[model samples]
Target: MNRRERRATAARQSGRTSPAALCQAGFAHLRSGRIAEAELCCQRALTLDEQHSDALHLLGVLCFHAQQPDAAVEWIGRAVQQAPKAEYLLSLATVLERQDRLEDAWQHYSRALSLKPDDAGLWNHIGDLLWQLGRMDEAARHLQQALKLNPHYWEAAHNCGMLLLELGRHAEAVECFDIAERLNRASAALHQMRAVCLSALNRFDEAEADYERSIALDPSLAETHNNLGLLHWRFGRLEQAFACFDRALALRPDFHAVLNNKAVVLLHLQMLDEAFAALHRSLAAAPDDAQTLFYLATLQLLTGDFERGWAAREARWRLPSVGLVDRGFSQPLWRGDRPLEGKTILLHSDEGLGDAIQFARYVPMVAALGARVILEVEPPIQQLLGGIEGVEQYIGRSSTPAFDLHCPLGTLPLAFATRLDTIPLAQGYIPAPPATRVKTWQDRLGPRDRFRVGLVWAGNPDHKNDHNRSMPLRTLAPLLDCDVQFVSLQKGVRDQDRAFLADHHDIVDLTQHLTDFSETAALISCLDLVISVDTSVAHLAGALRAPIWTLVPFNPDWRWLLERDDSPWYRSMRLFRQTTRGDWASVVDEVRVALEGQLSARRSRLVEPSPTPSAAPVPAAATA
Candidate 1:
C-alpha cells in the first residue's frame, strides 16, 4: 500500500481511531510546513491519549522551531518518559541543548545512542553538546566516533573544524573545513568558519575571499559583515571599514559591535556629534558595555566636558584590566582648601612631555599652600622645569627623592579648581639663562634687515594624529617664499626634507647647532615673532613670552579648548585654526596675512623711532 493508505490501515487496527487519525494528520501537516495546524493536530492527539509519544515529540519539535524552548522541554521530556525510544530521546536532547542544559542533554543523547549505537547523526549531536560544555577532549572523541560510524558526515566534520579553531589547531581546523566543503559545497557556515581560521593565521587575503564567498551564499549574515569590517579597519581602510559596519547594522539593527565600530570611525573623522549618537545607540542596546563606556568618557574629556568627563574617567578603575594606584605617597594631595604646611609633595609626570610642560604651571600653585614641592620630570625637560618657582628639587629618572604625597600632573586641574579664565598665563615663567646664550644667538643671526621669524612645522612623528596635524615641508612652500627672514627651530631634521631647504638662503636652518631647550629659549627670546604648527616650540615660545602665532588643525588638541582664537594658558600666543578638517591652506593664508601685518608694523616702528635728544650733540663737542 501507499504511505497514506498504510497509515490509515494501521489507525483502523489500533482501535483508538481519533488519536491515531490525529497523529497521522499531524505528520502530514508538519511535512507540508503548516506548523500551527500541525501543532493543533498534535495537541488533539495528546488530549485523546496523554501518553502518545509521537504526538508529544511532534509538539515539542514544533515549539522548539518556534523558539519556545521551555514548552519544548516540557513536551519533549514527557515524550521521552512515555517512550524511551531513539527518536523520542533525540527530541528531548534537542530541546535540552537549545536551553543550554548541556549535561541533561548529554544524558538524553547517551540514552538515544544506546538505542541506535551506530547512528552517525546521534553521535554528532552528542559531540556538539560535549563541545558546548567545554569538554574538548570528549567532544573530539565523540566527533571521531560520528565520522567512523558514517565516513561522509559533513556536519560533524564542520563542527570539528570549528572546535579545532577554538583550540588554536589552525592546520587541523583548515583540513576539517576542506573536507567538509568538499562534502557539502553549498554550506555557507562552513566557508565562514574556514575564513575565521584563516584570519587567525594572518592569511588575510584568503580569509577575505572566503568571507566574500560566505556573504554571497548567505547575504543576511551580520557576523560575516562584522568580521569583514574588522579586517578592513585593521588595515587602515577607514571608508571601507565604515561601509561594512553600515551593512551589518542594516541587517542587525541592534548589533553592539557594529554600532561601536561606527562610532570609532566617526571619532577618527572628528565627527564628534555623529560619533556620540552612535555610542548612545550602542549603549541603548548594551547599557553596561565597559569598553563603550570608557570610549564615551574619553570623547567627553577630549571635547572639554570636564565634570562629566572626570566622573566617567573614574569608571576606568572598575574595569577588569585597569590597575588602581595605591595612596602610598608621602604628602597628601591638596584638594583646593587643604593647607599644605609641613607637607612634602611630589608632582610626577603622568602622560607626555607636552602634558608635563602645560600642567607644570600648577606646581607653584601647589607650593603656595606651604608645601615643599619636588617636581618629578622626564629628562628632556628637567632643566627647563627646574627654574620654575616653588620646586625645591628636580627629580629625573636618576633621582630618588622622598615625598609625603604625589599626584598625576593632569589631575592638578581638578585639585586647583582651574577655570579657563584663572589659568596662570604669566609670561617669562621659564627664565632664559644670562647674556651668554643671548649674545651667541645674536652673533649667529648678525644683522638682519627683515623681521626675524622662527618656524616649527612638525611635531613628534609618533603622535597618533600626527599625519593630520603636522605639515610637510612642501606644504610650507607658500610661507617659505615670503619676505621675512625665517629660522628653522625644528629639533630633529629628517634627512629627506633637508635637501629642499638647502637652496633657500632666506631660510636659516639652526637645527644642527642647537644644543638644548635652554639655548632654544634664548634664541626664541631674540626673534621678532615665532610662527609654528602645534609643537613643543609653540609651547616654549608661549612660556618665554615671545609673540607667537600658532597654526591649529581643525580639531585642535584638547588644551586649545573649542572655538577660541587665543589660549588662556598662553597670553602671548595667537591661534590660526584650519577652516575645514585637514585643510591647512586656510590656516597658512591667515598666517601670511598676520606676518605681513607684523612686517609692516616693524617697518613703521623702525622708520618712526622716537626723536633723539638734540642736547646729546653738545657732549660730543666737549669730548673733542
Candidate 2:
C-alpha cells in the first residue's frame, strides 16, 4: 500500500472515532447525574456530526433533568425527527408535560404507548397527566392497568389512591394505600394517604399513628406535621398541637398554613402577643391571604383592641362567605350618627348562640333611638331576648322581615357608638322568666343556711380558645375547699371531667337536674355569687342581676373591654383575668382569696339588721 492510501484510511477512522467517543462520554455523564457536563459532551458530539441521533437524545434528557423543558423539547423533537424511537418519544412527551402543553404531551405519550404498551411506568405517567386534566375515570383505568402489568408499581397505586380520596371513595383509597405500603413500606406518601383516609373515617387514633409513621419516614414532610397539629387541636391538646405546628415551620419557614395554625394555637393558649407576632409573620410570608387577615382581625377584636378589631371585623364583609341580601332596606348601617326616628331596623344574630346572648344588651339601645327594632335571634335566646324593652317584634324564627336597616348582633358596637363607659349597666337585661318558674327554682333549693354559690368550670368544647378559657373540674379543687355550698352550673361535662367529679362527691351536681338556660337563670337568682369561666352561664348570671365572677383568659373577648376589673356591659360581673398565658393557678388562688373575704363578710352581715326586701334585688358591686 502507498503512503497516500494509508493517510486516507487514518482520516476516515479518526472521523468515526470522534463522534462515537463524544456520544459515549455524554451517556456516561448523563447516568452519573452530571447534567451540565453531559450537555457539553452531547453538544460537542452534535458539532462533530450534526445528524448524530444518540447525541441529540442524550442532550434532550440532560435538558429535561436540568429543568430546561423548552430546550429539551427542541432537542428531543430533532432526535425523534432523526429516529422515532420509543425512548425519544417518551422523553419528548415528559418535556411537553413539564411545559404544560398537555395535548401535545398526550399525543406523544399515546404514540410511545403504541410502540411499547407493556411499559408500566409509562402507563403510570399517562395516568398522572390524565388526572391533572380532570379525566379521573380514564386516569383510574390507566393506573389500574399499570398495577395489573406490574403489581409492585407503588407510584401507580399511590396515584390511584389519591384519585379515589378526591372522589370521596375513602375505603377504596385506603385499600390502594395499603397495597402501595405493602410494596414500599418506606414510602412516606403511602402512609400519609392512609392517614388521610383513616381521618375521614373518624378513626383519629389510627390516623394520628399513621401520620407519625409518615413523619418518621420523611422528616421534611411539612404537610404531615400540619395535619397532625390540626388533629391535636381538634382533640383540645393545644400544647401538642403547637409543637407540631412549630415542627412544620422548622421544616419550611415560609409554610403559611403551618404559620396560621401556630398562631391559632397561640390564640387558644391566650398568648396574645405571641399569637399576633405569628400572624404578622404569616402575613409577611404570604401577604393578601384573606384567611389570615380575617383571623388577625378576630383576635384583635377578642383582645379588646376595639379600633383594630373593628377594622379586622370589616374584612369579613369583603369575604365571599359573607352575604348581604337585598331586603329592600335602604338605610346605611347606623354608625350612631343619623337619627333613627320611625325607621325600622333589623338586629340579626351572627356567629354563634353565645355571641348573640352576649351582644343582645344593645338591642334596647337601638330601640331607644325611636326606631322600631326587630330583633332576629337564635331559637335558644328567642324567649329570653323578647323581654328586652323597646324591641317591637321578636323576629327570631324566620329571615323574611323587610327592614330599613340591618346589622349583625356583634357589630352593634360599631353602629350604636358604644363607648367603654356608656355600655348599658342596667343589670337583669334578660329577666328570670315568670314568677312561677323563679318560685319553682326557689322551692328546689329548699332551705340553705350557707352562702349559695353557682359554679361553671367549662364552656363550649368547640370554642376556638376553649383550651385556655375552660378549666378542668379538677382545677376547681380550691373552690371545693371553700365554706360556701357549691352548686354545679357546668353543662356538657366531658368524660375526663366526669371521672374527676366522681372522686369529689361532696360538691352538689345540679347539672343533671338543670334542663335549659331558663333553669340556669332562675338558679342564678337564688345564688349569692356565681363563679364561672368565660361562658354562656357567666353571661346569663350577669343578665339576671346575680353577683358573678368570671375567670378570663389572658387575651379575653372584646366584650370584656380592656384593662378593667369590672365589665361595662354588666356592672354585676367582676372580671378575674389570667396574668400569664395558660396560667390558671394564679387566677384560681385570687378567686379563693375573694371568696374567703365574701364568706367573712357574710358572717358579719348576719349579726346586723336584715337587708331591705324589694321586688328588684340589690345590684352586685365589684370590690376590685
Candidate 3:
C-alpha cells in the first residue's frame, strides 16, 4: 500500500483516536523523517481538538525544521499560551531566538527555568543565548551552572571551554575541553578546540598532536586543517604550513581565513608574487577583511611600493590586532586632509618605542606648519625626545590634552604622502642625550683606551617573531672575541643568557642601572657604535645620529625593505641580513667581518690626518 494508507492503517490498528495519542504518533513520524505523515497526524489531532498544545507544538517544530521560523514562532506561542508547560516554553523561546527576538526569547527561557529549575539542557540553551548577545561572563556563569547541574553534560562543558577560550583563559579552557573529551572522545571539534588552547599556551608539540588527532577523526573538516596550518606557521615550518593550507583549500575552496594564512606562509617562504595572488583572492572573498588588507599593505611596503603602502597601512587602526591600543579619539584623524596652519594637533605614539623614535621626525615638520604640536609618547622616551626642536609640549600619555586634531605617529608618513626618497630627516632628527647623562656613562667606563661598542642581541621574548629576530648572548661569542670592549644594551635578559653574561665579565652588564630610554640613550652616546638585532635600541641609536649596524632576519619587517644595506629611515644605520631563513650564524659572521673592517678603518683614520674632530655613536620596536 502507499505510505499514507499504511500510516492510516497503523493509526487504526493502534486505536489512536485522541488528540494526545495522535500528537505522540506525529512526533514519532517526525523523528523518522516522514515529514508529510507527521504533518498529517498533527493536523488530524488539531482538527479533533483545536486547542491541543502538543499537536500545536509538534507542528511548530516541523515548521522550524522547514525553515519557516515565523510560522514556527506563531504555532509555538499558541502552544505555550494554552499549556504553559516548561517544554512548550522552551520550544517557544528557541523559536523566538531563531527569529532574532533575543529579549522575548530570554523572558520565555526565564519562565521555563522557573518551572523546571534543574533542567541542564535549558540552562545550556540560556548560556548559548547569552554568548550570542556578547554577555560572555554571564554566559560562562550559566554554562558553569549547567555543568554543575549535570556533570556528564558534554555540550555544557564544550560551551564553557569555548567561552573561556574567547576570554583568553586558555588554561581554564583546556581543563573544560579535557572534561568534554573524556565524555565524548569521538568529537573532532572538541579535539580541535583543545589543540587551539594548547597552541595559545605555547605547547606546540601537544597542540600539533591534538590537531593531527582531530584531522584523523574527521578528515573532511576544513577548519581543522586551517588551524593546523597556523600552528605550523607559528614554528616556522613553512612547507608543512603550506601543505595544511593547501589541504584546507582543497576541502573548501572559498575558505578565506585559510587563504590569508596560506598567503602569510608564502610571504615567509619569500614567494611574494604567490602571496599577493592569494591575498587578492582572500580580499575578493571577504572584501573588507582588515587582517588581509593589512598583510597586503605590508607586502606593498616591504617591496618599496610606498605609494600604495602608506595609504593601505591605514587599515591597521581598524584591525583587531590594534584594537587594545586604538585610542578612539574624539578629534578627527588629521591625514593632511585639512590645513594644519594655526590648529593644535595631538601627535600620539600608539605603537612601539622604536616607532615613536622613527616617526618623531614628523613633529618638527608638523610644527613648521605653524600648528602647536603636543607629543604624547611612552614615559621612557619622553626625556630623550625633549630636543625634537618643534614639540610645543611633551605630555604624559594619561593626560587628555585638548586639541583640534589628532594623528597616530605611525600614520605621519601617510599624512605627508611620503614617497620612496622623501623621508624627512634621514640624517637623524633626534638629538644626543644631555651631556650630564653622557658624563655619567663616561665615568662608569673609567678608562677609554678600547673602542666602546653597545650590544643588543635580543628583542622582546613575547614578540610573535622573537624566535626569528632574537638570539641568546652565546650567539654573540664570535663578536665578543674582538678587541673592542662590548657593553650590554639589552633591557631584559632571558634565563638562558644570564649564565653566559655572568661568565663573560669583560662584557659590561650595567643594564641594572639603566632605568629608562634616557639612560640607555646617554650610554649609547658614550659608545663609538651600537650593534643590535631588530629592536628598539637599534632605532634609538639611529635616531641619535650614532653609528648603528642592525642584524636583520631573512624576511625582515616592512620598514626594513629588501636587499639593501642602508636604511632610508635612518641614514646613520646599516643593515646586516641573513641570506637564509633563521641563519643567524651567517649574519654574525658578516658582522664579525664588518667589525674587523671598522677597526681597520679606525686605525687607518688614527694614523692618517682627519679633516674633522673625532665624535661618537646609537639604538630598533614591533607591533618596530
Cα-based lDDT for every prediction? 0.80, 0.81, 0.89
Candidate 2 lDDT trough over 10 residues, lowest sum: 1-10
* Residue range 1-624, candidate 2, lDDT tens digits: 345334433544676546566766666667767667567777778888898888888878887787888888999999999998898898898888878999899889989999999999889889989988898888888888898899888888888899889877898888889889898899887788799899988889999999999999998999999999999988878778988888999999999878888887777666778989998999999887766887797787666666666655656655654443433446577666678898988888766667777778888788888999998877767777777877888876466777787777877776755555456744658766787877887777767788888888988897756887898888879878889888888889899899887777666776666776766777777789999999988888787778999999887776675577998677799999998877888999999999999999988988888778778877899798
> Where does candidate 1 clash, by residue pair?
330-403, 330-404, 330-405, 331-404, 331-405
Off by over 4 Å in 2: 1-176, 183-190, 193-254, 265-275, 284-287, 314-341, 397-399, 417-428, 496-513, 554-564, 578-586, 608-624
Candidate 3 achieves a global lDDT of 0.89
Candidate 1 local lDDT, 1-624, one digit each (tens): 348736745674686557767777777777778777677778778888888888888888888888999998998888778888888887788777777788998998899899899888888878888887889978877887887787688888888888888888887788888889989888877788899899888899999999999999998889889888888976778778888898999999999878987887777668899999999999999888876786787788667776666555545545654444444555575555466788888888766777777788888888888889999888778888888889899888567787777777767877776554467744647766668888888889988677889988888887766776788766777877667889889887666567777867778887776776778888887788998888878888888788988888876776776677888788898999886877888788778887787778777888896987675544445553
* TM-score of each predicted structure versus truth: 0.60, 0.63, 0.82
Q: Return the number of clashes found in candidate 1.
A: 5
- For model 1 the local lDDT of residue 299 reads 80
Which candidate wins on lDDT?
3
Strongest candidate by TM-score = 3
What would the per-residue lDDT of candidate 3 be over residues 226-327, giving only the tens digit for each residue? 999898878778788889999999998978889988888888778999999999999999898888889999999999999899888888878766553777
- In Å, residue 498's CA in model 3 sits off its true spot by 1.2
Q: Per-residue lDDT for 161 in model 1? A: 86
